[model samples]
Target: MKQVVAVTSKAQLEAFIDFPHDLYENDPCYVPELFIAQRDLLTPGKHPFHDHSPVQLFLAYDNGKVAGRIAAIFNKNHNAFNNTTDGFFGFFDCVNDKEISSMLFSKAEQWLKEQGATSIVGPANFSTNETCGLLVKGFDTPPFAMMPYNKAYYESLIGNVGLHKKVDLIAYRFGEDGYDDKSVRLKEAIVNRLKTKGIVIRPVVKKNFQAEVDKIREVYNSAWDRNLGFVPMTHKEFDYLAKDLKMILDTDFCLVAEKDGKLVGFALAIPDINQILINIRRGRLLPFGLFKLLFGMKKINGIRVIALGVVEGYRKLGIEACLYASIIEAYRKKKYKHCEASWILEHNELMNKALEHVKGVPHKRYRIFEKAI
Candidate 1:
């Protein structure tokens, strides 16, 4: 017999977080998310997302064993910003059984509907601002830091539940020796040209990080407003996310473009920490997990240029290329071998072209699914 149970107790919640560890135990590509981080993210009052929104966790049980888990999320800010009644499902994990997957989706749909959501979209662990999407392609390699990954069959399970594809997000990889130095030189010239117009590109100022973050948040929210599946992040939501990223943020890779003291563009790249987390064992940092993380930092070889945006007015002035050029140059100087610039919308031709121009090959893809309830 199969039963779906809302996770209301600590034990159930722990099961919810730990299910993936067991499910992907034998999969070499699987990287377990840190247990402590997952717990805090899901726990109300512990994470700021709970201050304005609601998320309900559920577990699917088959007789005495846990079969799956899901989180039914209602992002008040997302709905309000987009002016729609769309709910989200995230932190999804399930066994190979279609019956169990269906049960988990049913619970999520019912709860979302009760919250007045007319449609459900995701696998978004929280939001697009955070790690989201299912790896629909490129299963041969492990996922980069903060990226999502799952067995290929999970896509079929999601489709079986009638969730249709919303959009495909792409990840492009650039090898250290593969970047076009001519392109870099050209972009450097353009960057210098922009400088003559009083436009300056500089590393994020650590001393004024909060103020800088505030400005960057404005650009982030506004720049991505028209993107597929994008929802403006509320102040609280953005700050919550920024706080977490700050811990892993490499100042050198976090660059901002300012014109006349107004922030117009930004690019952020994060160290690929999955190499360390892979050894952390189910995302634990207890006794020795901390040692792995602390010592592993210096050895990371890959980077992910996760966020890059140029505000509307500032577009087409070589700002985007400059951001890319700067990061690629930094990677070269640091002896990093490769980087992934990812999750770009399929329809974003300009950004895609910029990457292709710089020799970033499209290597991985992810998709978001949606269903009208």
Candidate 2:
């Protein structure tokens, strides 16, 4: 028998978090996300997201054995920001069974309908500001830091529940020999040119970290404002995320474009800590996992160019290429094996071309889906 139930208590919530740990146990490519982080994100008062939105979690069972889990989310900030009553389904995981997937969506739909949603859209863990989209391609490799991964049948399962593709997010991979170094070669020249225009590209100042975050937040909100479904992250939300990433942040990998000593653009690449997390069973850091994390992080050989953007007035100023070049130069110095520049909008012509210029290979594709509720 297949059954679905709302996650109402701590035990049920723990099961909800741990379900994938069981489901993907045998999969070699699966990386366990941190338990404490997942717990905090799902808990109301622990994450800043809960301050502005409501989310309901559900778990499905087959013959009393856990089968799947999902979260139905209504983002007040997303709706108010985008002016759309679109409910989101995220943290979705399941067996290959089609019926259970349908039931999970049905429960999500029921709750979303009560909340006045007109369309169901996602695999957005919460929102586009965070990890969103279902992995429609690239199941052969583990995901980079902060990226979602899933089974090959996920596309069909979600489609069966009436959500069809809305957009595809693209991830590109680069390696030492494979990537073009034209941007890196021209970096110094580009920086000099931008210097003449009063814009300089340099590493992020760790000493003024909070102030630096505020400036980058300004650029982030402004730069990505026109993206599809993008909502400006609240101050607290960005800070919360920054505080976490600070542990893995390398100043060399974090570069900024400044004009008149104010941030005009920024690019940040964090060590691909997933490289270590993949070996940590069930994402636990207690017991022996803590030592692994502490020591293993220094040995991580890859990075994710997670964010790169320039505010409107600063566009077409070679700032973008310079940012990429600077990061690439840093990567070469560190002797890293690979870098994943990811979750780029498929139709973002200029950004796509920039990566393509550097011979970035599109190795993975993720999709956002939607259905009228």
- CA lDDT, every prediction? 0.89, 0.92
- Report the C-alpha lDDT of model 1 over 1-373, residue by residue, as the tens digit: 8999999999998899999999999788999999988898999988878888899999999988998989999998888878889999998888889999999999999999999999999989788878899889999989998899998999999999999999899999888788766646888689789999899999998889889989999999888988876777777777877887888888889999999999999999999999899888877899899999989999999999889998998898988878877887788889998789887888889888877887879999999999999
Which candidate number has the best TM-score? 2
* Tens-digit lDDT track of model 2 for 1-373: 9999999999999999999999988998899989999999999999999999999999999999999999999998999988899999999999999999999999999999999999999989899988998888888989999999898888989988888889999999988678998888888888899989999888888889999999999999999998999999999999999999898899999989999988999999999999999988898998989999999987999999999999988898899889888888889899999899997999999889878888999999999999999
lDDT of 1 at 67: 89
> For residue 154, what is the lDDT in candidate 1?
92
What TM-score quantifies how close candidate 2 is to the native fold?
0.98
Off by over 4 Å in 2: none
- How much lDDT does candidate 2 score? 0.92
Model 2: lowest-lDDT 10 consecutive positions = 175-184
lDDT at position 248, candidate 1: 85
